[model samples]
Structures are given as structure tokens and as C-alpha cells.
Target: MLSILIPTYNYVCVKLVTDLQQQAERLECPYEILVADDASEDAFKRENRKINGIPNCKYIELQENVGRSRIRNILGRLARYDFFLFLDCDGGIVNADFLARYKALLDKADVICGSILHPSKQPSPDVSLRYTYEKHAEHKFTAQKRMQHPYAMFRSFNFLISRSAFQACPFDETIRNYGYEDVMMGLALGRANVSVLHIDNPLMNEDIEKNAVFLHKTEESLRTLYVHRQKLGYCTGVLRLYGILQRMHLIFSILLLYRLLRRVIRRNLLGKRPSLGLFAFYKIGYYCNLAKERK
Candidate 1:
């Protein structure tokens, strides 16, 4: 009845898979779990190889590491069941009835977004950047708010999509990076007129990297976002504001102001318990810097 698909990269997912398997067993339905290793190291390989022996679960180790978007596309293609349940390796089952809630939503919408939740408490100092940002900006996304911006809010984590809808608009494989791929997929689904339903059921996101790693990945995603902005209908929202600034010949002045504040903003973001508002400014400055570099 469902296919639980997870893409792992050097992360141990034994606990996650076990929780999902137990839930599926309780449902008493036909289900398969697929875990693909994206060419991780020996330690992860040894641990994840255990999945190979599990019943109704397949473990595939690719010789080469395909980036985030392609790996998910690969998982979708490998899924045998009609409904595909995509979960990140770092995510944990928030509740025992997680799968059941998703199953109930199957017939109601073409795509389902089981929301994301962070731990109520903060993680360690080293890995707090992702936690802080998610807690402030993303983790609290309400079902009502998501409806207003379905395309922008439709993240790729803990969601169920039928085979027909997935094959209609698979993730863009050209995006071979860490960030904004979910945004890209959401945009595609919206353009195709696919209906998305949001619910309170959430996955506990456990993967938290150091501040430095988070910033690097954020910059990488910004690069990808700038490159794809045109394809994503660039002349909307903030882009419209930017276009107006460009027309009035104020972009250079704005860029210079951003450049002046970039270092101060970066200092705040890289520090302990950083401000997400400052980080947003940092990202805007970084993306604007990239945009200026290209011209």
C-alpha cells in the first residue's frame, strides 16, 4: 500500500527504519522500504548494509554519489508501490500513528505534506545553527499558513505522493546540490496544478550540523537559487521589488550598502545562538554579491 523511501549519505538509519517498519506492520498492509546509500564511507556502509538482510526492505549502494535531487528521483523510480513516502535519514518518526495519518490523507489530496518539527529544547552549541533557523522560520509552519503559499512551503520531507503525480513532475535532477531542491519541486508541483494537503503530523528532524557547515550549505543553495531564479518566475514578490530597484538604477546603491553590512551580519550568524533575521540579511547579501559577480 505504501513505499517508504529514504536516501542516506553516511548517516545511520537503523532506528528510523525500524520505527517505520513496526508502524507499517501494525497497519497490516502491503509495504516496502527502500534505502539507498549515496556512496558513503566504510563505517556507514557496514551499518546500513544490515538493511540488506531485512525482509521487504532493499538496500542499494551506488558506486558514485549522485546529489540530493537525483537520489530522490532514483528512489521514486525504484519505488514499487503506488504511494511513495519520502523521509530524510536524519528524521525520526514523531509518533506511532505517523504512517496512519499519512495513509488517511491519501485519497484526499494528490500530494500530502506531513509537517516538520524540531525538538522542544535546543541541541548542543556546535550543531545549533540549523536548529535555530528551523525553529524560528520553518518548523512552526502551520497548515493554514502553508495554504497561502503552497508552492513555496511544500517541502520534500515526510510527504506521500502517488506514482502518477511523481512521474508527472519528478525533482529537477539538474540541481546537484544540498539546498532549494525542495523549493524547486514545490514550484514544479504547483505549476502542474497538483493539489497539496498539509497536516499536523510531523517528522522529528535530528540532523544538525555545525554553524560553519550550515553556512556553507546555505551559500551553495543560494548559488543554485540565483541560477534558477529566472526559471522559477523571477518577476514575483521580492523579485518584483528587485526589478523595480533595477529599473530605478538603485541596485548598485543597495548592493554597496549590503556589502558594507555583510561582515557584521556574517559575524552574528556564525556566532553562538545567532539571529535568524541577521542570517536572512547575510543570505540576501551573499546572493546579491553572487549576482553582482556574474555581471
Candidate 2:
């Protein structure tokens, strides 16, 4: 009745698959778990290969990395069941009833987003940047708040959608990058008037990147947003600020200020005691810099 689809790149997912398999068996539901490895390292590939031993689970390794978007589309096509559960490889099933919760809501809406949860306590100092950002904004991630702007808040990290709905609006494979794939999908679903329901069910996000790695990925996401700004309709607040600054003729001035303080901001972000306020400024400045370069 459900197809659990997980797309991975250089991460071992044997434990995640095994955990879900046991849950499905207990519920006595017809489910299959499919894990797609996107040309990961040989070590990760060997570790994830153990997933095949689990009943109704298959580990498919690709010779080439098709990227974040296409890999999901490929999994959608490979799904045999009516409902698809997409989860990231680096996450864990914290709740024992995660699958059961989704099973009960199979017909509640066209799409159900089970938001992600971060660690309660701060992890290592190296990973504190991401942990701090997520924890600091935990209030906004609750089900009630997310339901207020369902489409805008929709994340592909963990969600369930029917086969017909997924086929109607698949992930845009043209976005061969690290970010905004989920935002694009959410926007498409909203435009199509697809019903989205947000629940309290959250997947435990286990993999928190180090400060340098998180900042690098954040920049990558900004680059993706800049490249597809037109298609994205500039929905983000940063872009909105950019528009406002442009009308005021302050784009270059702000860009100059950003250039002056770029090093200082970088040092803090890479440090143990990073500030989210500064992080926001860095993103805005980086995005503004991208616009300046394009012009």
C-alpha cells in the first residue's frame, strides 16, 4: 500500500531501511523500501548494500550521479504502490509509529508533509552552526505554524504523496543542484491547487554538517536560487528585500557594505559561536553579490 523511497549520496542507509521494514511488518501492510545510491563512494556503497537483505527492500546503485532532482523522479517512476514516502538517507526514524501515523493519513490529503526535527541538545562544536540555526527557529516549524503557509513550508525531507499526484508534478530534473528542488515542488503543487496537510510527525534529522560544510552548502543553495530566480518568482524574503533595495537605488551600496564585511562575517560563521542574525545577513549579501555579478 506504500512505497518508501529514499535517495542517498555517500551515506549509509541500512539502519533506516531496517527500522522502517520492521514497522511495516508489525502493521501488516504491503510495503516496499527502495534506496537509490547516487554514485556514492565505494565505502558507502558497500555499507548500504546490506539493505538488500531486508525483505521487500532493494538497494539500487547508480554508476553516475543524476543529482537530487532526477534521482527522486526516477524513484517515483520505480514506485509500485499508490502512496510514496520520501525520506532523506541521513535521517532517522525517531518515533516507532512513524509509518503507522502516515498509514492512517493515507487519504487525508493529496500531499502530507511530516516535518523534520533537529537534536535537542547541541552536538559537537563543529556541527553547532546548523544545530543552532534549526533549534533557534524551532517554534516556526511546528505543525500549526507550517499549516498556515503549507506550500511555502513544504519540505521533501519527509513526506507522503499519491502516485497520481507525484506524476502530475514531479521534481524538475533540470535543477541539478543541492537546493530549492523542494521549494520548486511545493510551488508547483500549490499552483495546481493540490491539497497539502501538515502533521506533527517529524523525522529525526541526524546528519548535521560542520560549520564550514554548512556554510558552503548554504552558498550552494543561494546560487541555485539566484540561477532560477525568474522561475521561482522571487518568493523568498531575501529576494523581496533585493527588490525593495533596487527600487531605492541601494543595491550597489548594500553590495559594497557586504564586500567590506564579508571576511568578518565568514570568520564568525565558521567559528563555534555563530549568530543567526549574521547568517541571514551573509545570505542576503551573498545573494546580492550573485545578482551584481550577473549584471
Candidate 3:
């Protein structure tokens, strides 16, 4: 009794749903795969509508685009099984036993984060920022490491949760943008004292945005965090650093350095070989810039 819930936007997921359908069929268990398209483009809508033809699968297209948080909530409410497996539409079912792995652990904990993996084969430099970031940080996401700080490491890309747990701590609907929703969920789940079990079941991240696009999304996520920092009641590295700088009266110095190096950092990040160190500074500076704008 598992519900495979997927939310899509401007991306075709017939293949994803088909692969999942086959896996569920093998389990010989009662499972339904639901794909909710968040008012994607006409092409994607047409392509994903074919998911309905697959056995034990249904596709629903929304009239209006409900942001990321609401779309997942919509699918959670629509799910008919005791357990819900939330997978991003762009995920590639690399392992045939993905569903089986989750099914084996359904009773182990209140929540299970399957985690995500970038492609083993690196992409071209033109679109490697996200890849580099993910690859370099891959060690940090291992089951052993994640278990140390389960709540902070919880990711939404591929995770399993009981329907009861989901209903108790749903994604914060107020977050209409792209960042920290997972962190917020992790916090809420922690507050609810929901048991989380980290496992090695990973889905390959099939879609990696180009460097510039990812940079923009990164900024949007930072803005989201900054906007809702109070509600989050958590301190990310960026937030912690920001607070320290503010308290030490060093904000102005960092702002000045950031302004001077902004162009250089942008150039490096957009180039073939980007420096992750500079990328880190860019985020701090960008976040500080946002704070300055508000004041």
C-alpha cells in the first residue's frame, strides 16, 4: 500500500511514470502513481497526459500554477495509500529495485529520505556548477553522515513518508518560491518528533540547469530563506554568518569587498571553470545585498 506521488512542471514524465509503474507491478502490491502537472507548457502537458494510459497511474493537470509547496500538498491529499513516495518529475529511476527498497523500510521509521545522486559522468564545463556542487558535496550526503544530522540533511527530491506524518507536517504552503522548503519540512518534522530513517536509495538527478540558470535559482532560494528567516527559526550557514557579521559591525566591510569583487565573481561563476570558493562568497554578498536593499 504505497502511493508514488510526482509533481511536474514544464517537464515530460511519461517515461518516469512508466518505469515506476513497472517497478510497482513487480512488487505485486497495491500502489497508485499520481502525477500532478502544475500548469506546464502545452507540449509537456500533452506528453505527460499519456501517463493515464499506464496501469495503476493517473495524471492530473492544474488550471493554474500552484507553486511548488502547494503542488506536493495537493498530491499528498490525493494519495490513497498508507505510505507516500514523493519523487521529482525529472528524476530517473536508475535502480529497478527503487520501489522495493522503499517498501522494505516502510515500517522502519515515520519518514525515509532516499536521497539524490548526480550523474557519475560529469557534464561539460558550460553546465557544471550544479554538478560540481553536488559531486563535491556527495560525501556529506552519505547515509552515515546524514544520520548524524538527519533533520538538516533531509532532502525532498526523493523521500518516503507515512500519510499520517505528511498530513501532520505538510510543506509550508506560504513558501511560493524555490528554496528551503525541504529545510522547513525537516524542521517541522523534527518539531513533530517524527522518526526519520536515512537510506542509500537514490534517484539520479536527470536535469541539471546551466550555470547561469542555476546561479539565478540559487539567488532566488537565498531570497526565499531571507524572506522567511523569522518563520524558519533555523540558522543556515549563510544566516549564521550574516548574523555574526551584523553583530560584529563588519557588515559594511563585507559589503564593500563584495561590491568590489561582484563582477569578478560573476565572471568566474559564468565561465568554464568556476571557483566554488568564490561561489560561496557570491552567495554571502548576494544575500547581504538583499538585506541592504531592504534597509
Best by lDDT: 2
RMSD of 1: 1.9
- How many steric overlaps are in each model, in order? 1, 0, 0
lDDT of 1 by residue, 12-115 (tens): 99888888888998888899999999999989989998887777888889899998889999999989899999999999887989999988778998898888
TM-score of candidate 2 against the unseen true structure: 0.98
TM-score of each candidate?
Answer: 0.93, 0.98, 0.98
Task: Give the lDDT of residue 78 in candidate 3.
Answer: 94
lDDT of 3 by residue, 159-215 (tens): 999999999999999999989999999999988999999999989998898999999
Clashing pairs in 1: 1-30
Considering TM-score, where higher is better, how would the candidates rank from best to worst?
A: 2, 3, 1
Runs of candidate 3 with Cα error greater than 4 angstroms are none
Report how far residue 95 has shifted in candidate 1, in Å: 0.5
Name the weakest run of 10 consecutive residues (lDDT summed) in model 3: 231-240
Residue 293 CA error for candidate 3 (Å)? 0.8
lDDT of 2 by residue, 1-295 (tens): 8999999998888889999999989878788999999999999999999998999999998899999999999999999999999999988988999999999998899999998889888889998789999998889989999999999998999999999999998998989988899999999999989999999998898899999999999999999998888888867877888898889998888889899999999999998899898999899899999988988
> In candidate 2, which residue pairs clash?
none
Candidate 1 minimal-lDDT segment of 10 residues: 232-241
